[model samples]
Target chain A: MRLRLLCCGAALLLLAACSSTPDESLYSDGSGQLGGPPGPISPDGTIGSADLNGGQPAPGTQEDLELTVGDRVFFDYDSTVLSPVATETLDRQGAWLKQFGSIVITVEGHTDERGTREYNLALGDRRATAVKNYLVALNIAPERILTISYGEERPADPGNDETAWSNNRRAVTVVTTVN
Target chain B: MTLPRSPRARWLPALAWLAACLVLPRAAGAVVELDITEGVVEPVPIAITEFHGQTPAEQKFGRDLADVVTADLARSGLFRPLDRRAFIQSPAELIDLPRFADWRQINAEALVTGVITGGEGGTELAVEFRLWDVFAGNQMRGQRLSGTPDQWRRIAHKIADTIYARLTGEKGYFDSRIVYVAETGPTTDRVKRLAIMDQDGANHEFLTDGGDLVLTPRFHPDGNSLGFMVFRQPVPQVYKYDLLTGREARLGDFGGMTFAPRFSPDGRWLAMSQAENGNSDVYLLDLDSGRKRRLTDHPAIDTSAAFAPDGERLVFNSDRAGSPQLYTMRPDGGDVQRISFNGGNYGSPTWSPRGDLIAFTKITGGVFHIGVMKTDGSDERLLTESQLDEAPTFAPNGRVILFTRKDYRDNHIRLYTVDIAGGQVQELPTPLDASDPDWSPLRP
Candidate 1:
């Protein structure tokens, strides 16, 4: 047990060191053209102002997003139809994919442990494909997408309850890199 | 009666007189207690001397019969065949005037000697086997079986079964076949088909094509038909695949998901769990009339139902009590009682063929284990602990189980058998990745 704690602590330290890098700066050229500084303000100039925090805007930096698990998608029992809320969440994910334009994402599908082995495998595939097709319809490249189904093998929540089942029947989006 | 001895005869006569005195029913019977906790896993010492023939046809059958017996005993994992190169005496010498000292020196605890005779239609095998207790210096059991040359392998298997039962006090797993699902391809597009192989994992043939996904193939009471779930169309339903006629008829549709089907001991009813809407429940279908009976009515999921050998009750998995624990109920869904409360979750409850206990998969501390408990859920003992273990199926003799063990991320599953007391774990070799193993009922 102590070894587990030590390993977790070391992992947290590594994440902290990795996340401390400074961001890059993006300034306005007073004409909506991104350049060094502002030119003389015209009469019809509408400068909404730059980000006041003065934090660095790192080049090629996509949105630092952590895809939360359960809130993304929900599946009916043994069926892989995407719920309405799931479609809305995937729309936001599709926007992320469009705005970033660089990162490739992997969508992993899982299921609850209440069905046959082969059925669950097919169900997991359908769930992942539902999400992948949504992303493709949102103008995301089908070439940048890769999917894998774990069936009921890997559970996001290990409890054998409705809460766990709802969380386990999900499709996860994992950001790999900046293109 | 004592044999007439020419030279050294005094002590032999006296010993015979003493044996008569003990058999006269005058003395009291003695009670003995022995602690036999330890025994060697070494193969039983056996010597199969080649049989000889007096006629030409006799010569042809005798040699072949002896070879069959040798192969049978060697493949049983319970006996060792003394190499023919180490034979000190010829077959004729040993059959007529047997020298016990020569066999003892070669570490043979038992020796099988035989001869062949001509019959009207086929060659008759006059086979005799003598099981000697080399350590105790006495003969244990001896018998002779007469069969034709065409029935030679049956005679050999019978000998192996007798020898194995005598030594281990348990029925042998030979003369059996294993039916399992063969898997290939990636997890998404996995091609799963029902396949059957010999008990030693040989002569594997596909029972169904991989065009459709098959899951959890179980043997019927007669061992010729398999109860499984197949997704041929968009619907997932249960069906029985007959080995003789190559016919597969749907086991009646339950509207939603229906899977994890198994046959009762009498082959009259099948217990399966079907999902309606989002809720899953257990149901029993009469094989003859296709009449369906609802067994469990709960909002929570219940599945993996197995019938006790007696067919009056069943053990199944349920999440009604908040987690997936085992529960037993009557065939009519009465007398429902919770049987497991030890830990994280349990699924796949398979009643032992002996009708005493049920084996299941227990998940605790993030590791899956194969565990067994009595009918009332007492005396829970975990047999094997691994990263992921599931699908515990018992051998027909109720002495061992064949379950899949998966480690690392490779998913190379191998079948393993362990004693009922969780000892003597041996891995059954298979050519490919196998899972959902079902041992056939004992051969008729």
Candidate 2:
């Protein structure tokens, strides 16, 4: 009787796996490319979740480096210094960079479209400089880094609020690996 | 097909009178007039005869001066110069006789003929221009001017200005440039940089790379530098950039937000808004000393300040009265009085260059509009009503206001100009979307 129950449970599990959504059907090989059907569920049981916690992209997805507000550090109303949490994330990013070893990066700094042009240029300069400075401290060659600023011309989120503004204030680090 | 040639064309005075009478009547007009709100934008028919001078150098100066005038006017998307090959007479005789019949045959409605002579320090450039009712064969207006060779460019501008004023009844934009925040990329990650273009919207070049978010770029009184705000991580600081050298430095250390900056007409001081602890107020920074003096003490949002043309008074936007409205005060920050009361929240109040009016953005009934009023806040006229229209800057003559108009989708932005009389408004085309247009001071 116990063996019969086990066989029934296995059959139900196979049926559940076959009914997975398209997003759930995507899977990546260890080589970081699409390989096969996605596991019916993530190890954590979330079917359609971002793999940011694992420092990897979801299966079958291209690597997206576009910086959003959530990925960047926010400052107080008038500050530019990176916070502790920001530093921690940078550390993880630095480890990733060390592992890749052949990637060139450009860091862009930006602000909310609240200030004037000349001031924003200088402010953006400082923000990009801050990120570049941090990367260099992590033993990355300074020669491989390029910095630019868009002041407030670009926004990840266009809403006019603390939410949007926080997203707008960011320094993005984009990595390009030499093939 | 042969009309009798005027004696002026042949260097004979007698035949000129005969042709003038025969061809002149076409220039007369009945009392009826039509408003020219729109046209095909055909080039204005203009003829610049080679100017003569006493010496070869002076003569060369004369020709160069005419060429400059032709180039300036022709490039303005306005005037079309008649080919010199079609001229019936030499410049000297054309100035003396001005046979309207000869000009009319070639479709030349306006003519400029001049001569140059040696002056104390530079070649004396003298120019004479006539605005003609070509169809009527009558001269509308004529004037002669003399200045140094170095002033040849100015003389050309003056002529263009006069001709434009006479033909269109509107001031010319030939002597101006536009400073705008140039935008690129997707809606989510837009890259904005400071850029300047000729007043007609040509010669666009980025002053700063797209790395930071800059806003409210205003040309200094001299048109050589710009003052704007920069957000460095946590602080929005004010700074000025010398367009010629690309040298930029901090304008002031407001500790909080320093924005809405404008340079006094003399370029000696800057007026802007400073927000500390969430309360924005107006302040002025002395360009030389970098010393900031508070202009307003209210706790409400006091921003978008501008100096009157005379540099003795200022106009600014303030919500101190419960909603945004325009206010004026003496340069010393005294005698503050309300200047706008028609309705809707008003901000970005820029004083007219002529010192007679102020242009501002008004938000009322869920629409954004560009409006103008006298310095005393009277005779208000809304120039444009749009989904989003703000940042109005005046042309040097105070005849037009150039501002940004955002489309209904909030995705596209275009530059537009409106006549101060509220009669004509036109959109300026650009390869890419543009915003935050700041008009340069009249070319010196």
Task: Report the C-alpha lDDT of model 1 over B1-444, residue by residue, as the tens digit.
Answer: 322111122322211111111112222221111112243255667787776667766666666666766775675445788987787777777556457678778987766665555532554555565444544444444556555554454445555555555556666556567898887765435677888876656557777778887888999988778899886544568899876556788888666657779898999999987765445688999999999899999876677889999998999887688667899999999998999988777878899888998999888876788889999999998999877677889877676678877654664667787666665557777766777899987644
- Candidate 2 CAPRI assessment class: incorrect
Per-model C-alpha RMSD: 16.7, 13.9
Models 1 onward score TM values of 0.64, 0.60
Cα deviation at A136, candidate 2, in Å, is: 35
Worst 10 residues of 2 chain B by lDDT: B12-21
Q: Which lDDT tens digits does candidate 2 get at residues B121-223?
A: 5534555555556556566656675554444555566666766776766666565678888778876766778888767654557788878767778999877
The top-ranked prediction according to TM-score is 1
Quantify all predictions' global Cα lDDT against the true fold.
0.67, 0.67
